[model samples]
Target: MLQHLLRLSYPTPADHLDPEDHFSTALGTIFSDDLANQHGDRDALITYLPSTYPAYPAVELRLADPAGEDERRKFAHYLWNAGVLMAELWWLGREEEHKWRVKGHAVLELGAGVGLAGIMSVLAGAEEVVISDYPAPEILQNLRSNVERNVPSQLRPKVRVEGHTWGDVTSPFPAANAGKFSRILAADCLWMPHEHANLARSMRHFLSPDEDARVLVIAGFHTGRARMAAFFDVVGDEGLEVEEMFEMDAEGKRREWRSERDGGAEDHGERKKWLVLARLKRKTSINSGSA
Candidate 1:
């Protein structure tokens, strides 16, 4: 069954208008013990699922240093995203199912900004999880640090961090890893419309050939519906079929998000950002014949 997972709205810090700063301040307060007192740009610790997993323990994440005024990396310091959080919650909710899906399987995460989804996958019992992003030294280094700090020692061996750029199929690492992943995850990666084809090519190259192998994608609607639709179109051209798609509103309402059109009447207010989630699988000859 298709499920739309919604993120609960919380009050933002009024002092910081930047979403990243607001998130950092709010998270620091929530996970005070993990916050360091260093004054300069340093890592901040945030807790995930503090209430529910108190015994097993809330996951501690050491995020990358916040972007400075002249920071060249535009997307690295943005530690939090509604879609990624929603995807994490969805996986946590279906713990047993996810464990079954990932157990003894290879998993890969693209555009793993803070490594949350990939970290969660490792914790959920994936045989191996490769977390990847743009090949910026700072971004890659921070990603490695997060995986090292948060993931238990026993599971750390199963997680690896790599530097990957979209559309580089000829690269040695990607060429070697081609069709090797049973599961692929991408959260908030469709914001850039120009990168749609490149992202789709990467997905095609990495996605395993098995019928059950799948890719899970989640994105916020802030980038506009047209751009999101274009991404799906490119993915379709790359031979992936959307098995299920849905949207979740701030009120936790779940509704089907059809792939047929660009715009809808869905509210995009400050508190009403919609999350679009989809499960995709390779299109087989039989499925293509039917289409």
Candidate 2:
């Protein structure tokens, strides 16, 4: 018998919503520790059953060793804190004034490793959702499988999985998706300082020109807050402004975003617990880039 990942477990109820869709974010996570997780990965077809989401089905991920610097590293193997934070925020999303959600919006998830945010967006009743990542065959295949199995069938039409390399304007992805996404979600994607400009350019490319359009970002402190700051520098260069930014711990304690703590006294444990969540919008004012 073959293990087929199916959406049979996630059914649409008569109320036009899911049973646990609007459950609650007060608890921060569905599963205990690391925001709840599942497991499975091994041989033949060597299909991986990487169960990152507690509420969703396992995705089939096949790892391929790359030759160039383009494939130097891969972060899709595990579900990080920032990814979990975004998912939990969108779970119920009633804790704050600016609730994390995608209802009635065209959502585009950048660097969608394992497609967690976009998958949750579909459950949150988004108008449409496009889950994207590097134009890697193995990665894109896994994204498609996850979307097919985790998202409700009726809403599958509203979701698209595409191969998108950040800032690659020379390619067709940018032109096709330009100004189409009302809400762009990026989680744990600001780590590489070298890629900040490219990432920012991609955000500008897909982000809708509408006043209400915004980019939702959540990055962990594990990689150093300085890298996060560098990403914002590029965001400004790309005509984007930080509407709001804050840090929240795994235990759900919210705080204002600030400079990184001293490196010498840094606590790896504490760093693992903190995540910076921010909202970015296009700078529309005449003197938008003055800062």
Candidate 3:
């Protein structure tokens, strides 16, 4: 089954707008002792997941000057983990040749918090990749820096990184990006309860006209299954389809751990990750046989 990731804010009888969507800083915030403990035991400089060979160096997403450095670090750290985990799973699916079938094609990524998917696409052989975020100038600046900092000069292809708000249509895309791109990738971008409409609109804009254009998305369960249903409804209304899905093990970790408490502690609904391969539907040509 195709699972819906990050559907925590789908509409109900009385759904109110979430201020975080509008007023939250470009670098969001989070503070949890559990996350901090995880960071401390490991090298804060860089780390890579075990599965990906010739492993890519890790990058941390940090909150920009929040009330306290401690609080800001938590949010930034988890955001990076989300991106890394998503990329790792996608790469695992394509490990047969250690390259992507969509290589050498134009690519675009939305809501790229730490640029993991875009970076991975380049590593997998994209001709040119554009990393886009919200219009917030500062946040966009950070995204650009990460693309440059983390992307090794040798492996980096012709890449352009920039920020674009969800609803803005006039923003400039790469010349080849006018209607090109064999692949479109995103992860953990659907969580904003209040921004589903805006997100749907943006996906339609950046999505390619080729009905077979490849799109691989991995999203975690944010607000449980109800919220996910709403996101799927939005996607269906916009003419996209979810092709496949996977779920993580208990404790929100990507892999299973052998521990006694895990036996009955798992909530089947919240432990899954939705991996979707979707594409935009092409409009019928007036002279086509079907038409």
Candidate with the greatest TM-score versus the true structure: 1
Ranking by TM-score: 1, 2, 3
lDDT of 1 by residue, 1-291 (tens): 111121222244444356674564455457543321111123345555522354434455554653454333446555445434433544334643552266577999998877877887787778999999887777788889878878899888899999899999888889899888988888878878888888888887888887678887877666567667678877777777778777764344667785433346544443125667778888764243221
TM-scores of the models, in the order given? 0.76, 0.75, 0.62
> Which pairs of residues collide in candidate 3?
7-227, 7-228, 8-223, 61-76, 247-272, 247-273
Name the weakest run of 10 consecutive residues (lDDT summed) in model 3: 1-10
lDDT of each: 0.66, 0.68, 0.49
lDDT of 2 at 239: 75
- Of 1 and 2, the candidate ahead on TM-score is 1
Whichever of 1 and 3 has more lDDT, that candidate is: 1
Q: The CA-based lDDT of model 2 is what?
A: 0.68
lDDT of 2 by residue, 147-263 (tens): 776776888899998888887866776777778888999998998988888888888778888768889998887776676667877788887889888888766687887766775
Where is the poorest 10-residue window by lDDT in model 1? 1-10
